[model samples]
Target: MRSVFLALLVAFFATGVAAHVARSNSLRDEKLTFNPTNVHVKRLAHTPRTLTNAQRLARGLNPARPQLRSSRRLAGRGGPSLTPTTTSTSTDTPTGTDTTTSTDTPTSTDTATSTDTPTTTSTDTTTSTDTATSTSPTPTPTCTAHTGVLELTGGSYNGYVSSETNSFGEYSVTTDASEALQVQYQECDGAVSYGPINFKTLNGLSTYPYLGGIVGFSSSSDNLASNSPNYVYLGGTQESAAGAPPQRGANSFSAASGTAKDYESAIWSVDPTTGAFTAHWVNTDGTSSAPTIMVVQDAIVLTDDTFRFIQTYGDAVIVSLTFAESSSAAVPPQATSSA
Candidate 1:
């Protein structure tokens, strides 16, 4: 009887150990990919190197359909794209063949320092004028060990603001692991710390169309009660509101740690020819408190005639990515250290 009982116990322990090891191995192998979801990819007609607009017209062909709408950029919920063993893949629906109706004056102002540069290629009907200049600065907060990426456990994080004094709806973002692009944002107490009021124009590529969104974060010391763990939040884009806030606002990204762990994001928009653009952000989560700023650039088609609208934003340290029909990136002016 004793020997039989010992054999049963050994079998059960072995099974449990195997299961635990398998679970750990599975989790440890998980990673983030380079593929982006929710991305409405458009394939514009390819333009061969030999062909120029003037040459096409000279050959008795119509000039490329002129690209109308001004220019903008698409900031992102960017991370390394995940190349799936099997794979998968937003915006308005403009009917009929992609068309343009204006001329473009060429200029450039983007600097890609250890970041990506937008690549633009439009069809024969469109005329494109663009310039890109990139510079690399030194790396900060450096460490000797270059540990490669380990795991990208996509999940929810709350970014709140609760100081020794008061707290407000800070930035927060929630990302799903299964579907990378399907993200939802939330703001708790009302207007975001730097949302809505002070937004900026989108900044990315000049030719390709793109969507815009804002992601925010902050650190919390405790719940409303004043003692617990810190949390982060990646809320949705700010809506247009009543009183006009600064195109720049104030946020500390803290909740009583005597330091800073918070950040704010305000998005705005502009037009194709550099004019004012407005948007009423009907957030995915049912809030129409304020209108969000939205600027649009020349909508471009890819080699396959796919379409997208591009936008841009100010360059603050980007915490998370926001998504919207039309808006710009928010680069918060440098915040002073915690006092």
Candidate 2:
């Protein structure tokens, strides 16, 4: 038994030596394993007097809440309810083949997203703070095929072409002699008086941030069905109302049907040249106190995608606005040159 014990000890030491040799040889090829991040506690900033530590702690959770990722763009709609404003659109082709809708969602490929919500979460032992910040996103690169690059010589405005039946993923750029031509990489479903609207590809759009359809219903005030492409300002009062004077280039006839309670002043306006809505306005049932909600939609850049411009104005406000492009008539593509 003693001799057997000595032999076992020798075998164990010999095995350990072999294992050491193997480990030394594997040192160069061995992979490093990183452990999970350790729990970290942090101080949350506030107005100092606003939310006390007790209040913050009251909202605290012992174990972190299970996070359900945010809803994706192509997520299916839930059971139907009284959501009259709910619009659904399908994932469109890159060639702009599908007729877009208010409900249709542009695939994530058309729009890249980043989280910007500011939040502070606390637990029994730890606290965390998150903030939302504005940032310009990187521009999407376009295939350098010279399909619809159009340009003109001496014009103050830009232009648009409406012939392409399959323009979903396709983007085009056009310009007058002056400005760099703007391009539309993708089209989502929204009734737009699209006049060379700017889709700033670089730094995500921050300054001139708000983009809208040239002629679509307001997100909130839709029961009134305030459609665009009308003289958004010329309503509730006569062309020669008490406070309202005659507007220039205003529609010659009323757009509404039946015994007109009021002249059908255009609910929206478009650029005649490029045919896009430059401004969005609301008629206040003839109440003459407020001037108008002259929302500046976009500016007139040579690089813009202008189809037509609508001329609209009112007595109190001149409404010197920019325009988008629209064209029901046959439009020929313009010539564009790359630098």
Candidate 3:
């Protein structure tokens, strides 16, 4: 009996051991077949739930108060409460999810410019010139060519005579035949009468028994007006008829012998109207001589066979005489001669 009890206990132990080994093997097989990639872990925010004082009063509960405990107090009995307290702990972790966003916008800028310019210029010029020119005058001549003829009238020799007659009716004569002797001059211009002169009525000749013949006659002017003074020059041969009574001699020719052809020569300046006369020259001897008279410019020239006399008139009167041989007596032909 006792053996039988012991065998049974051993069998019970062996069964218990088999059941334990099977449960352990099943757990190990489940752990080995599980997929870690298919397992999903959910995360939630860690927020603890709390109640306000009003909520606590509405639920007929007192408000929570802070507890002050001493360091020696037990943690299980820290404070007293008017109501049952409950505590909840969350099992959650924070997740990394980005919430910032990005965007694009626009900006502004400006530009402008300006420019200007100007210019000017000028010029000028000039010139000039000049020129010139010239001129002159002429001259006159003298008239000397004159010709005429003279005739004696109302005299003892009433005929044509050889005499030099000037252009203005004046003539030189060597003799006068009557006291009333007159001269007539004729030319292409006209004819004129010179004198009805009386030699017996002349001064210094009134006492002569016979008045002498005229030797020469001249005047200061060729043509004179009727009222002008006649500066007349007369040359004379003072004579008495061949055997007349001797007259009282008052000049160098006073000692004349009473003979038929004996004569003395004298020169007189006379006034034709009054018969007044002044004797300028007298022959000292009884010689048959006479002077040829001429008017040259303002002078009276008288030429005789041996002498020449020059008497100038106007402004100042000068008288001069010179001895000259007669050209008619010269043996040689003269280179120059005057008639």
By TM-score, the best candidate is 1
Pick by lDDT: which candidate is best? 3
Q: For candidate 3, lDDT tens digit of each residue in 218-292?
A: 322222123322232221233333223222332111212111222222232333233222223233332322243
Tens-digit lDDT string for candidate 1 (142-197) = 11110010011112322211111112222222232221221112222233323333
Candidate 2 per-residue C-alpha lDDT over 1-339 given as tens digits, one digit per residue, 9 for 90 to 100: 999999999999999999999997566223211101232322211112232434222222122344568666666878866534545455556543443334322211122222334643322322345679998985543221111112222223234311111111111223332222222222223224332322211111111111221211111211122232222211122122222222322111111111112222222333435533332222334332112222222221110111111222111212222323211211112111111
RMSD of each: 33.0, 42.7, 99.7
What's the TM-score of each model vs. the native? 0.17, 0.16, 0.16
Full-model lDDT, candidate 3? 0.28
In candidate 3, list every pair of residues with a backbone clash.
Answer: none
Better of 1 and 3 by TM-score: 1
**Over 4 Å off in model 2, which ranges?**
1-178, 186-211, 214-339
Clashes of each: 75, 59, 0
lDDT of 2: 0.26
Instruction: Give the alpha-carbon lDDT of every model.
Output: 0.26, 0.26, 0.28
